[model samples]
Target: MQRLVLRRKEFSLFQAFIYKNIGISLGDHKIYLVQARLAKRVKQLGLESFGEYYDFLVADRKGGELEYLSSLISTNVTSFFREHKQWEFLKSHLASILERSGGRLRIWSAACSSGEEPYSIAMFLAEHLPNMTQYDIKILATDVSPKVLKIAMSGMYSQKACMSLSDEYLRKYFSPVLVENEAYYQISDMLKKQIIFREFNLVTGDYDLFAQKAFDIIFCRNVMIYFDRPTQNKLVDRFHAILAKEGHLFIGSSEALTDMKKEFKSKSASIYQKA
Candidate 1:
């Protein structure tokens, strides 16, 4: 098979399309990177050129191809308890958060790549809170890609994925399973029931669906670095709008709201409270 090259023109079209739909800013130098990432899919589909794939995506009225494209371009490098500092902050303020909520809490794990974030949230709460079933807590885990959501719904993980978790968490939250004689850890149904997974495109999804709802905590970490400034500001504003009073927003420590004016007051590194 002849190597398919993503021409400059095709790269420009994809760059604009991705930014418009997903709010990701791919630089001009990323032409090769995009090509390398997407070339296999293009080849598997028997497409002759990247331009043809673009046309296919445009003609895909159901938006499935675009979701697949989003998956390829976006990295899904996540693990159990990836951000240690954020959890520490949450632990410090957990009592106040519970007091404010009065035993009811809603958390949104935005861009929940492969379900580890929400699952970790469930496990953490079960570990920290006094009663196992007293509080009302639910996690809404959403992502733009359906492919990842399917994996999340399965609640299965490789042994490598379980490395970050503690032995106690492993014993309480997960069950060891043998899949074709290979070891795998599957999250217990008790924890799985605590989460609701859905397909949500943060850049293009409608916020009106949340007009009547507000979350106590939102975890939109490590995702904004892919977006440009204007896009980031717009997305941040949406998050601010849907957060309950004094609700918390957790972002990646590396990603900061430097020049943006907003209602959130910084409490700690990458942790914000709605004012």
Candidate 2:
């Protein structure tokens, strides 16, 4: 059988398919990238062309192929304190925010990839909030990738992932371990207990899990670039609705609310406050 290759026409078809199906907009310039990401699947299925692969994906209902598609397209590279300044701001204001909230704190790490961001939030809370044990402090960590969510649930990381972490943090929050001939560190039970991980898609517009509960803080950083302007506005509106009055929304450093509604006011760099 001849090897299958993704051509321009098939790539355009896929761009339309993904945009209509999942709201992911891929430009014509991404043809090479599409080919690279899906070539392996094509070969594995013994497909003759990218069109067949596209059809297979469209007809796939078991979610295996959909999951693969998400993995290929979603950007998940993150680290502990990737945006250090944001963490610094959180640390500075968390105490006052918690106090004003009547000792209850609800934070959401939206699109939390591989858990570092949520765990970092948990650690900061654990360290600064002395009366944290008395309050109802919860961190809702969500992501679209089931594969990444599984890793996040495990709360384990390699030394490389922990390199930026200070020695004190490592000693205070994590315990070193060797699992399956690999060196890694696992988050302490104290920090792990404060977080709840689940799979969620921001594009779905269903937030029933947080229907009754409004968050005091939501860190939806860096995930919106994948979405189009209209989708971005819709998701931001949802965030505004779900956030409590004066709640903080932290986006990626590079992402801005160019077309965002007037309900949110810019509070700081890449930070917005509900109006």
Best by lDDT: 1
Instruction: Give the Cα error of residue 201 in candidate 1, in Å.
Output: 0.4
The residue-by-residue lDDT of candidate 2 on 66-91, one tens digit each, is: 77777777779899988888888888
Q: lDDT by residue for model 1 over 1-275, one digit each (tens)?
A: 78999999999999999999887999999999999999999888999989999999889999889989989998888999888999988889998998998878999999999999999999889888859598888899999988899989999998999999888888888999999998999999998999999999999999998887789999999999989888899999999999999999999889888766388999888889999
| The best candidate in terms of TM-score | 1
Global lDDT scores for all candidate models: 0.91, 0.86
- Measured with C-alpha atoms, the lDDT of residue 65 in candidate 1 is 90
In model 2, the Cα lDDT at residue 91 comes to: 83
- Candidate 1 residue 223 Cα shift, in angstroms, is 0.4
